[model samples]
Target: MAFFAALHARMTGRKVGQDRFGNTYYESRKMMPVYNRYRRFVVTANGQDPTKVPAEWHCWLHHLTDAPLPEDKRLPWQKEHVPNLTGTRYAYRPKGHLAMGGQRQASGSDYEAWTP
Candidate 1:
């Protein structure tokens, strides 16, 4: 299924730019009938995770910005983007999380319980 999607995107879309992560961004060569506008999309270099897209590229992909990151002027204080790590080994696990393999730390007196 991904193969077909890639093929269709390649045939119908024009190359925009690639991010440091290797994800390639594309836009429809012609306006799409359904949306009545040109469609924009990205092909992830690693997996099917949408969060893999960086902030700059994401803006272009969602039509939030008219110019790609390369043409846009970035602020000096801007930092590089990072993808979510929910399912990976680097995913965050609180002290109480089951995967952490330890008993949950007690909630102090300030903790309040919610009632229906």
Candidate 2:
């Protein structure tokens, strides 16, 4: 996030909550001029990385829910949340991926060119 944005949020936005990842949520204290509804946002602990925002917080940030779901309210079937790792070392690399040695087993349906 930019320094000016952080300053604006801190000055005008009402702090909603902070997530486990250290992100702080906020909303405009008064109704916005054109939209009427208050504006919502997050002051990210890390830089502005959208993937770092978790599911529950994402929901609230988008105004899907009036408030964020309590972190402890998760059900037993839910697995532990992991942030997006697309650019990191632990990112998924399938058999055909260049990082995975660029080799893939030929499939039964492999297309062949017609020699008329």
Candidate 3:
């Protein structure tokens, strides 16, 4: 319930900035008091992938922008940040695959024949 209340506040907050992945950031001159201790006017996102953050909002979050988002800071060679992949299947697999190349022995049942 508290989380939902805080989310409501964030949705109605003074729209500060939005990220590339539709994540939005909000700020208040005076922190809006919350009934729940964990809920407050704090920065948050759906998840932590830096790439999810829009360029402008990311800049602001990282102290690069003073007025929401700046255009001059955009530059080439800036690799987009990707989320940490630790346990996902898409994660890197060294050299050994599940099917390592050990041939299975034929079943004894294969030699059995039907007598006409």
* The candidate that achieves the highest lDDT relative to the unseen native structure: 2
- What would the per-residue lDDT of candidate 3 be over residues 2-112, giving only the tens digit for each residue? 467457756656656555545556654454366221211323455434445555555565555555665347679876646556667777655454544545557777677
Candidate lDDT scores, in order, read 0.82, 0.88, 0.53
In candidate 1, list every pair of residues with a backbone clash.
none
TM-score of 1: 0.73
Worst 10 residues of 2 by lDDT: 1-10
Q: Write the per-residue lDDT of candidate 2 for residues 13-78, one digit (tens) a residue.
A: 988999999888999999978987889998778788888888989998888999898898889899
Candidate ranking under lDDT, highest first, comes to 2, 1, 3
If scored against the real structure, what TM-score would every candidate get? 0.73, 0.85, 0.44
The 10-residue segment with the lowest total lDDT in model 3: 35-44
Residue 31 in candidate 3, Cα distance off native in Å: 5.1
| Clash count list over all predictions | 0, 0, 2
lDDT of 1: 0.82
Better of 1 and 3 by TM-score: 1
Tens-place lDDT digits, model 1, residues 1-116? 66666788799998888887888888999998988889999888876789888888878888888977673566889876768878989999998788988778676665778999
Regions of candidate 3 where Cα sits further than 4 Å from its true position = 1-6, 31-51, 54-59, 62-65, 71-73, 93-116
Candidate 2: list runs displaced more than 4 Å: 108-111, 114-116
